[model samples]
Target chain A: MSVMASTPSAPVKPKSNTRLRNTLTFWAFVGPLALGLLVFVYIPIVWGFIISFFEARQTVTPSQFVGLTNYVDMLTDPNFVKALVTFLIFAVFIVPTTFFLSLALALLVNNTTKGTSFFRTVFFLPTACSYVVASMTWRMSIFNGLPFGFANIVLGWLGVAPIQWINKPDPPYFWIVLVTVRLWLQLGFYMILFLAGLQEIDRALYEAALVDGAKRGWQTFRHITFPLLRNTSVSILLLSLIAAFQAFDEFYNVLSTGVGSSSNITLARPPLVYIYQVAMADQNYGRGAAGAFILVAIIIAVTIVQGRLFGLGRAEA
Target chain B: MTVNTQTDTGRRVIDRSERIAIVLNYALLIFLSIIFLIPFYVILRNAFLPSKLITAFDWTWLPMPPSTNGWRDLLANTNANIVDGLRNSLVIAILQTVGQIAICSFAGYGLARIPFKYSNIVFYAILVTLMIPGAVTFVPLFVLVASFGWISTFQGLIIPGLFSGFNTFLFRNFFLNFPKELEEAGLMDGLDHFGVFFRLVLPNSMSVMMSLGVITFIGAWNSFLWPLVIGQRSETWTVQIVLSTFMTAQTVNLPAIFMGAAVSILPLVIVFLFMQRYIVEGVKMSGIKG
Candidate 1:
């Protein structure tokens, strides 16, 4: 322990020598990370904008100037627009429903005095499970789209007719199936966020409200708890939205046609899927890059708007 | 007398409410536990069954008669190099976790404890990168990898995720909470910064770093896109990519895929079971809270 400057300069300004040495050391430590971000992150992002200006087909070499053509095509493109609409519908169905269910789960777990830790761990465990595994499980086992599958098995219990999960039109079965699976894996993660927020709240506030004329159940939550958890709730919501935009794995592996009959319940064009198809399946790198940039723009724009609406700090104070 | 009667009534109501709360609490608990348990059983039972039994869509509490022949077949791949995927994942995860914690601890300590100009800018830049997705950079990184001739190498697998902004940020938060007096004493005794950081700072950070290491291990172990894109060599493929291949299987055995997946997850499950506390703490840092 070296700092004995308790009565020295009040601000304890770091000595100039120390500052210079520290600066060098800090960058030395940060060099690899800074280099990674520059090469792999920042440069590519800016290069994404730059590539949009060029008609760079592959590997960033010998490409022609297609200034604004990609962007123009993206705007006028019918497929892009259709997928955008589909994505909007998907988001609208999933995000709010996921968050509220998470809140309910969190509240349930938070209220239970017995096995509180056990329930929290159990609920949170699935979130750590890989998305590919979860998505695969849903595709093959649970909503396996067969007579004796898990969903149909349960439906049999209630005597309801078996229905295709990702296909049925009237019930909008695809949306429900996709959203339910996503929410099942998702709610636990956010529940922990909500739990953390709950933990941060002053318990004395709840006691004080109880001491006053405030009722125990809803009043305590309404007046004391919910407002305190707003920041965490907003954080969870924003992260979920960001994640939803890049909903690729489920689309890629789970709903994939992968040697299966493509005639069943086809959502053929989520943005990422479309881009992936263009590049990998069809070797259309130009369109793929264009689509990726468009997604980057959409994600950034949406994140900014949400941040403004919710006042998400760049970092907590 | 009326007030006394009213107070008695209120007490009785509170008692009844507590009783109701106790009953309803376990009901919710049972329901939530089922939700968690059911999927696991589905995977487990389905994984052990034959293809015909599996794709038949029978959702039984368990496979009628569990057979280990599927597992025996999978494990029989002694020279099948079934473990190449697991080895690749473990290597990448271990290297990245160690490298990240080492680099980030040094950098985080400096950012939190040392007062340097432009520290905040650097930190903010790292934070901003968190919001950016891997797809945005995939094109350039493709070029970088090709240029390095790392198309199918361990270098490709490890290098891309070597520097983690999230890990750096976590380490910084941990360090900011570190007592400066210990570091000051190290400095007073004439230890240079590196000496102090490695000798003193890291040991104190053993628990936090362990948690971060476990989180990083899981993240790398479970990485998909990067591994799929980078690990083109069959020997370099991580377990996630290998397991995902089963999703594309047509005439493949369901039990074999399950056994493979179960083997893939065995390491993670073992690690998780042992250090769920650190896993929880790591989740707080890498996931839930952030």
Candidate 2:
């Protein structure tokens, strides 16, 4: 330790041997982590892709070569097509709503005066709670059908008919529940993101805008805040889309069971939940694996298109 | 309506704008806060209602009068060992948090500081894993854990969760914002990369570590699906898992269920309330990317 410490102040001499030893030591430290990641995450993912090609059914004499069989079924499966459409509809609803809501909240919280943290905490507190618990609470207290839930009671106060948000005939209503629950939960996380973006802006810009007799309304936002936050907007948009695409837990608990089968709410289930059913409930492992890969492909494709459209990835590169 | 107008500038009429902006800001914030808080209000209000009085409508609106019935029922026969669920949950949450913090920081340090070969490849590998959904890996993971003789034990629950690619990515992402000269200085001072990383880097990155620590601990505490598979025994069930069992009942004691749900969400909410300023600061500080 003393010898190594003395190297900074004392006469420095090149020691090729020590450098080589340090490099070796670094590799040694990294070896276990790399191998673990390979075997656990990477290998399984590779195996998943390979497994997609075969009919890996346990009931028969194990998995065998059924080349293009999985993809063939996947291509023709009506439910898969339906789920894709439904999920597209979900993303369209969720992404924009989350985008604006978080932006609006960030604007609101950016004031950061006394007790602003309280509102921020209250808003973000739900993110810490799980989907299952929130869903259950929503089911019990708020969305209760007739006069049972909070939404109905509020509607009742306004002399309106109770619209079953979850159990309505339109599957999209259920999508709304899923989407809103998702938005409500994730607002604070993104708000934090936006707040971070806000802090990076040069205060001089706001001052300069103020100097030009800018009003409280459009000028402050247009000249000062909006231009500064373009990059953060792209990120929020991408992350929101990804989260909507991967929407699982809320949908799982809110809408009971699978679509085209027996959904207590509506005939709409997202890809991951549908895949979960195909894999776990029906034990259709091969089909389920194929569906998962299909979803992954769609997510990657959509994310790429979005990244290009927003110019986010190009800027990063 | 207070404004900072000590300077004389005909061009910049800022005092009126600042006052108007302050009022508009508070009004807008208060309005947004109402919108943001409605769901939480709904959950909190309805949980205390008597189950029978609850219609599928308006069941959980304003508490007419506070009622303890729901809570009493939810915790009824909580377990043979009363605190076992809470105990197990705490243990798992703490262990997972501590373990993940250690592993992620070390890996993050290695990635950020150690000038090794193929470092970018290693970092990208971590990032790519985030896209692979848990549904894809659950089966193989289940098989792997089962094979390792780790099922239904605390070790099985805690060990697999300790290595998080996302957390590592977050730390390493924030680590770049730090001036490398301090680490370089430490390197010159007799400190190896590991020593510098341990002593100098971590000490400076307390906020990032603290924020991630809270998030990680809460996540571990609320984990259900993984615990469901691994926690085979009744005693092994987390509080959330135990509460979920009530859903399977044909006649759900609503009060009890709500009570349990409320109980589960409380500690997290409390933690957020107390540590939130630091938490938000930490998250913002950590959001800096290369």
Candidate 3:
């Protein structure tokens, strides 16, 4: 209530009087954040790069400087190659599925007239649910390979035998468990993004299209809605790509049964999981750091190439 | 006459199709809602059912005579340390949220309102960090924290994440659009810039603060990998790390697992239900700016 600017007093301060104080205040405000970024982000990233050139495993200090050996080792390692290939497969599977599904969901919710808020909340509830919980739910209750598990229970209804979703890595149907959990967790978040984009479209454009012979919803969407939603769609795709590459939680937790099972590593380990194993589990921080940089390179290259292809940040066509 | 009769039939056909469409729409929505809700239902039911009866899936959809065995077991299990995990997570999340709000908003206000020569450079430097994926810095950050002997300490878990670049950017953008008149009035009354920020600017920032606070709190609470690595000791483990321990252990207690999962996410679900509008609004805000 006291936030009004209508008080009667001097409107403008003498500029020179407060300049020095202003400068000091400015630094006081911005200093902490800059210091945080430097210590946590900038310095650590540089250290990560420097450590990748040496053999700094199992110890805090780096004494041996085998330039490019760590990088070369990771590049040639079968496990690293396997991890990259696995992530690529995952990205390929998840990116489009999530994009299309979220868009479809956004369209559905947008079309609804009543209980719109109710449906939106229900769909968005999973976004609040942690991936750890979701992964556990999927692993034990849904796809546990038991006769009475949720997926198997449904399979029984069709007179089919229960499938070992996580254990059968030969054909790799575990992708179902991985992909579905991510889809359920992320779809509603992206749906909200699409809804925001949809809300921004001019109603007049739709009315005009309908009046000028666009009698079907599909036609109107094709000519106007889809094109206008391009920016949101591109951003969603880019974010999904980044997230897919960073896929670790569900993959690590769901596939591994916690004891003496080396199957999870060879099953579908992503770059982060691979790096975690190499660094923490094996005590090879040098190689782990190198693997991290390599993964970062791939992510950067993909992002730049995708941005160019999509003309992301460019004015609308 | 023929054209008029044709129009009449066409309109009736459209009405009948519209009726069918509405029915089909509700059916599809209801079907998907059930699909979305089943996992939650299963977890909730299993959390209340006795551990022995958990695997006996005779449509255990609703817990019969709902027992508290799972909750009792989880709280009593010393190795699990679910309560301690929850406490640590709360400390980290709350302190980190407070720190972020203070640090980011101050910098945001400085960048947006203060007429400084190097502000743009500072802003862009922070922005550039966003492009670098967190994977690039993960190992070295852990190394640095370890060197400081901060492993299993609150400083290690909380300090590095105190300020978010994206959040600082959000605050800057929000402050830029903020009404300058309020601050100008404060200045007219002999209040300095800092005074104005404290008295007027911050009070008016309730909505943005709430949005960022909730989002950041949820993120900090649900974070797994970082806490798993940093808080290796059972004493310092966050709720996520503790729950994940169940996944990695030799013995799997189904009821305890469900209950732990349920309890881990309970705070977020409560916050979301009560402030659903703000959360949705927050998503929209991020989408527009992002």
Candidate 4:
């Protein structure tokens, strides 16, 4: 492993003749993708940061360089602040619920005697379906603010009046719609992650635990299964956290009016939706770019904190 | 005799618990499956029902005497060009998938096998790009593409998404763990790196390649925000954008929108049903590695 680690940088000893050809081959293979990443990803990121410092909008060039002013203005902007709080509330609600639900499903599916793949497929089928399709199905048909909506229909049978699920504000049932759609879309993917982790644990470990008098399922799971799954669980949590921070599709599709309109944005609006509204709809590219960095900083900070808490890269003892 | 009796009791207890667990598992799975299937059921039921029937307060789990009015209206609706959107989506998804596989796999091979000086540095550089949230680059990327006069064009939609940092990492990891003997044999047979990659590596990489291809296609097909931004023109709209348009319109026609949604999801559902094993493997690969 150590030799392989140093192999790329270490100079080849005997192959002195084809050195030029080898270098050329390397460039031919890597150049296009590296160029693509440089131009599309790296350059844009730098340009975005530079533009954030200036008052730029509706044009490629910044009109003026007002250092950190865009950031300050966005920080004070009530809409941006509201959007952040909304995202936190969303992340707080979503991450743990998704984690636990997926873990439970994975445990259940893993323990099943027969038809494991069938259940796995059934659960994972939603992950294949796009957020757009799921959101549309949810917003228009299932949770539409009509008396005949799916949830309302369920409510009606219980002798309750129909409630406006999508449009409701006071109790904010839209959260339910948003949360459930996201859960439906993502739970199976994470469950598969946990299932993979579950499968990776040594069967011998379980037998040994059983032989050592750990007869109860929970005891084995606690001592053998859960500890062994630490890496998968940590990464799953990290991915979920990042995904939550990046939440845009379902909320935007389900909550907002169409593109170029932010009329219905409230409560459940995520940071991306707000930045998109500001940058695209309002055409305030500077603040939008600044807000993007702000969101990135928060995500990075959270990730670092998570990494520290989990000792993420540390090898198991 | 004592040992035989003890083992018998143990086996019986195990059977009882296992049997109970089986019953519980099926029961739980059945209940959750119904919940999971409900949204799909709604979409399918509404897709074939008349607008009035779909929106009516009466509740039925499945459409009774299913009508084709929704599908008809969906096709007739001016705002949603379902056929054109489907064609455009297919074109974009296919292009993006082919582009990523070709680009990332080559890059991965170079990083893994070529052993160029500074290759490690280059790899680390690519990996670091993953740290930068995609949102940070969103606006400027639009501007960059727009400057190239690519906005609302296939270039705009396809070029920017053609390569991915994560995919490159996946391919690199795959190649690093790939059998070196095959490459050595190909080299011994006078095959250059390119020839070896084409004849030996890629053919052997069907599993990872297919996994990447399926996931990428699904992603490209379902992508909403980018296409919504870049494909603003009605003629260039992807299926997802069209679906979003149907729902977010000022006056949403429920039955028609569901019909559109159902149509968009039909291909994916088929793909999932047939290639579910690959899909699960792809997702598993993604999770385990990370």
Task: Give the top-scoring candidate (TM-score).
Answer: 3
lDDT of each: 0.73, 0.71, 0.85, 0.85
How would you order the candidates by TM-score, starting with the best? 3, 4, 1, 2
DockQ by candidate, in order: 0.48, 0.38, 0.63, 0.70
Query: How does model 2 fare in lDDT?
Result: 0.71
lDDT of 2 by residue, B123-198 (tens): 8888887766554355445445655777788888887787777778877777777898898899889997778877
Would you list the clashing residue pairs of candidate 3?
A: none
| lDDT-sorted candidate list, best first | 4, 3, 1, 2
Residue runs of model 2 more than 4 Å from their true location after superposition: A1-20, A58-62, A257-261, A312-317, B1-25, B56-65, B77-85, B130-156, B173-194, B223-236, B285-290
TM-score per model over all chains: 0.90, 0.85, 0.95, 0.94
Lowest-sum lDDT 10-residue window in model 2 chain B: B1-10
Docking quality (DockQ) of candidate 1: 0.48
Q: In candidate 4, residue B39 scores what lDDT?
A: 85
lDDT of 1 by residue, A162-251 (tens): 778765555667666677778877787788777777888998998888788788778888877887887787778777877777776676
lDDT of 3 by residue, A1-317 (tens): 34355444324443554676677888888999999999999887788788889889897557699899999999999988988899889988999999998998888888889978888888999988888999999998898878768898888888888888888777787899999999999999899999999999999999888779786568888999998998898889888888888888898788866554565646888888888878877878888888888887887788778878777446454
* Ten contiguous residues with the weakest lDDT in model 4 chain B: B132-141
Query: In DockQ terms, which candidate is top?
Result: 4
Alpha carbon lDDT at B153, candidate 4: 93
Question: Can you write out model 1's per-residue Cα lDDT over B1-290, one digit (the tens) per residue?
Answer: 99999999999999999789778878978887898867777778877776666656445566768877677766665323457777877888899888877777767777777667888998899899877676545644654565578877998888778777777888888888888899999999999888888899888888898888888888788777777777767788777877777666554556776777667777877787788888777766755432
Give candidate 1 misplaced runs (Cα > 4 Å): A1-20, A58-62, A167-171, A259-268, A312-317, B55-59, B73-82, B287-290
